[model samples]
Each structure stands twice: as C-alpha cells, then as structure tokens.
Target: MSDTAIRVTGRCRCEKNPVRFEYTKVPAEVHYCLCTDCTDISGGAMALIAVVERSTFRITQGESKIHNYDTKPTCHRRFCSECGCHMFLYVDAFPEHLLIHVPTLDRGQDIGAKPDRYVFVNSKLAWLTLPDDGLPRHQGWANSGAPVEV
Candidate 1:
C-alpha cells in the first residue's frame, strides 16, 4: 500500500450525503464480524469492518442527517436517518477506534486493506461456510491480530 495519505468517502443510501472523510493512513486492521451486535444492527449476515483511528475520521457533509443509536449501553452506531444505513460506530470498549463499515465507501475506491481475520465465528450462521482464505479464525475478539479462544 502507498504510504501517502488516503482519504475515503462514505455515505448512506439516501444519496443526499457524501460524508467525506480521511483516513490519514490505511486502517489499523480489518475483519469480518459475525457477532449478533453487528449483524442485527446492520440487518446483514455479517459485517466487514475497518478499525480506524478516531482522529482520522471526519464528517464532511450531511452532518444533520447522521443520527446515533445506543445499540447497547456503551456501543453507539451512527446512521443516516433517511436511509437507515449505518456508516460507522464508536465502541466504548475500543474508544480510540471508529469501526467503519467498508461498504459505505465510494464505489470502486481502493480499500488498501483486506479482512485479515474472521471474528465471532462461534456465533456465525450455521449455513455459512467460511472460505479457506488462510486467515485466522476467532471465536471472539482480542482486538489485535490474535484470535480469542472461546
């Protein structure tokens, strides 16, 4: 990946937001989460997340359209009130990081990083079969490249 600074743009489905933002650098980590907290919130089978520094994320547009929901207690998911699509989340458990949903990025934008691991696999849907991508699998999150033993 290029060491040059890369800015990423993300938005909701309303087509009213360009929610421009910068990532200073590439993401610290990326992964697929099968946790119910993620799936249930996004209404998806799983979530592809990029853990980025909070200092690097900036909201450039449609600020008023963004709304926050305290999915649990300290977990906050921010979405567009119009389209109800989640763009990013702030987890108190990992305060320094903003977990961004990769799909929100502008079309054809290079992510510069790929999912390095699969997490919360223990809770993964029974019908889903993981590919042999050679990445580590974790039953839970260790917040690093390391996998947790469930």
Candidate 2:
C-alpha cells in the first residue's frame, strides 16, 4: 500500500444523472461473494466487494439521493434511488468494515487489492462456473489462520 490515500467515487448507470461518494486509504481486501443475500440483493450471480474500514468511507455527494434497505436483519444495503445501483452495505458480521461494491468505484480509480478469494461458494448459482483462477474459494469466510472463528 502507498502512503497516499486511495480514493474512489462512482455514479449510477445513467451517467447523465449520478449519485457519487468517495473513500480514501487502502482497503483490507477485495473478494467475490456468491452468497444468496448478495446475489438476490445485487440481482447478479456474484458481487465484488472491497472491504474497507467504515470510518474511511463517506458520501461526498448525493447524500440525500441515497437510500438503504435491510436485506436481512443484520445487513443494511445502500443504493442510488434514481438509478438503483447497489453501492455499499454494512454487515453485522464485520461492523468495522464497509463493503463497497466494486462496480461503484470510478472507472479510472485504483481499487486497491485484486480479489484475494471467492466466498460463499456453497451458495453460488448452479449455472455459473467459477473461473479457473488460483484464488482460494471458501465455503464461508476465509480462515486466515485466525485462532477464533468469525
């Protein structure tokens, strides 16, 4: 990671009108999530999320235009109301982290880490074949050799 803060922002699909936000500093890691909650809420086979410290994220613009929904009792997802772009989410499992959808980052910005792993493989869509990449695939969260299970 570089000493300079890594910043990113993005708009909804309608490039004409957009809701934007920006964040700084390096993210912990990026991961591909295939959990049902992710797929259902994002309306996609998988969702790519950059996990950054919550305190480092902020809505620089369109604060009033963003809306949220609790996909589950413990998961609060935020999106642009107009274009309906899923932006970020706060998960109870990791309260200190903000899960920013990779698609929401400005096109030219450096999004920090490449995906280090694929998560929730057990729930991946039946028709979707994961790439033959070498990244670790975890049924749940990666163990990271942590003594305490998350």
Candidate 3:
C-alpha cells in the first residue's frame, strides 16, 4: 500500500448534496462483496467498499438529507433521501469509521487499489463466476486480515 493520501468526494444521485471524504492514509484493505444482501441493496452483482476512518469523512452539505437503514442490529446503511443513493455503511463493529462505496467517489480520485479478494462468494448467484485466478475466496467476511479497531 502507498503511504500517500488521496481525497475522495461524492454526492447523491441527483448531485443536490455533496460529501467529502479524505482518505488521509492509504486503506489498510479493500475488497469486493458478492453477498446477497450487498447485491440486493446495490442492485448489482458486487459492491466495492473502502474502509475509511470516520474522522476523514465529512458531509459538506445536506446532512439532513442523509437517511439510514439499520438492516441489522449492528449494521446501518446510509443513503441520500433526496436522490436515494446508497453511499456508505456504518457497522457497530467499526463505529469510528465509514465504509464508503468506491464507485460513489469522484470520477478522478484514484481508489488506491482494487479488491484483492472476494467475500461472501457462497451467497453469490450461480450465474456469476469470478475469474479463476485464485484470489482468496471467503464464505463470509475475511478475518485473517488486520482487524478494524473500533
């Protein structure tokens, strides 16, 4: 991972409100999630999430427009109420940070790197098959990597 930091900015689908997230430090990790829940929420096959500290994320405007859905007791997904754009998710396990979707960031902001592995492959639809290059595949979340400290 590079030591350099990059600024990431995003907004709702309508672009009415904007949020800025400064990745002051390179992410400890990044990954693609193919879980059913992720796919259902994103309306896509997978979700690209970048684990970032809460301190680095800021809602520059339209804070009230951000709505949250507590899917589980420990998991909360946030989105723009006006545009209904799913931007980030906050988990009780990592209360001090935000998991921002990489695709939501500004077009030019380099997302550091792509996911090195896939998680929740067991729940992935049978129609979808990832490349057989042999990256680590996990039935659920990967616990072998550095744990995110809350």
Candidate 4:
C-alpha cells in the first residue's frame, strides 16, 4: 500500500470519550519488551510494542480524556482516564517516536509490521519462558550494544 494510504486505528478500553489514535505509516520497529516497568504497569508478562514516528501518529478523539503518567523521568505513558488503559508512551530516548501497545490496535487488521525481536531479556521474569520463536533476544535494549547469546 502507498505510504500515505496506509492507516491503522486503535482505541482505549472506554466506550465513551475513548482515547482514539491513528498512524499513517508502518512502524519503525516492533518488539516484545520485558522491562520491569512495562510488565508491572501492564500487569502482563511482557509488552508488545510498535515504535512509530511521532509525525505519523495522531490522537483522533478523547484528547482531553487522555492522562499522562511519568513512569520515569524519561518515559511519559498516556492512558485513558475513564478505563485507565495504557495506550502509548513517549520516551526521552526516542524523542521522534512513540511506543504503542500492540494489543490496542483493532483486531483482524494487519498491524503494518511484525515484532522482530525481544528486548530487555535481562529483566525477564525467571518463571516466564519465552516461545521458541527464533527472534533475536536482546539482553537489554535492542540497540544497547549488549551481546545476544541466544
């Protein structure tokens, strides 16, 4: 599909004044994040994230209903005020991009990309076993320059 024609829509859990968002291009990167902050806040084993350019993303609705919480000094997570569903986050380390929770996207439509690797494996819970997906597993951030043994 043409770059400008490609669009993906997603929303928070709220039925009213839900936080709606859309992106016009394929994400730059997609990965499974095993960071403690992501897993703890999401209440999940890991977070599937799609890194998209800020210029291609837009909040279509519930702008006022979106609440931001600084998970840390560098990470500002935005969620729906009503449902408290975390939708996206801005990281100081990637100023030009936004990290979106993959599950927030409407099902049945292509997410425009596939997760290529796993990040923060160093912080992965010991009880959680990773799938034998053959994706590169990074010990830290994907670009952290740390060696991947598996």
Q: What is the lDDT of residue 55 in candidate 4?
A: 95
Off by over 4 Å in 1: 1-4, 144-150
Sort by TM-score, best first: 4, 1, 2, 3
C-alpha lDDT of candidate 1 relative to the true structure: 0.81
Write one digit per residue (lDDT tens) for candidate 1, span 1-150: 557468777777775454555576678889899989999888888899998889878887788888899989988999888888889999888889999999888878877688898888878988877787788888878454566433
Q: In candidate 2, what are the lDDT values of residues 1-150, reduced to their tens digit?
A: 568577777566656557777778788889999899999988899999999988888877767878899989999998888888888999988989999899878787677668888888878778998887777788876653322211
Query: 23, model 1: CA deviation in Å?
Result: 2.3
- Local distance difference test, each candidate: 0.81, 0.81, 0.74, 0.90
Point out the worst 10-residue segment of candidate 3 by lDDT.
141-150
Model 4: per-residue Cα lDDT at residue 41: 92
**Model 3 stretches with alpha carbons more than 4 Å out:** 19-22, 144-150
lDDT string for model 3 (1-150, tens) is 345566667666765345444456555567788877778999998888888877766777678878899877787998888777898898777778788888887787677666777777767787886776556777777773532211
Name every residue pair that clashes in candidate 1.
Answer: none
- Per-candidate TM equals 0.88, 0.87, 0.83, 0.94
Clash pairs of candidate 4?
none
Residue 26's lDDT in candidate 3: 56
Best by TM-score: 4
Q: Hey, what RMSD does candidate 3 come out at?
A: 4.8
Error at 69, model 2, angstroms: 0.5
Of candidate 1, the 10-residue stretch with the lowest lDDT total is: 141-150
Better of 2 and 4 by lDDT: 4
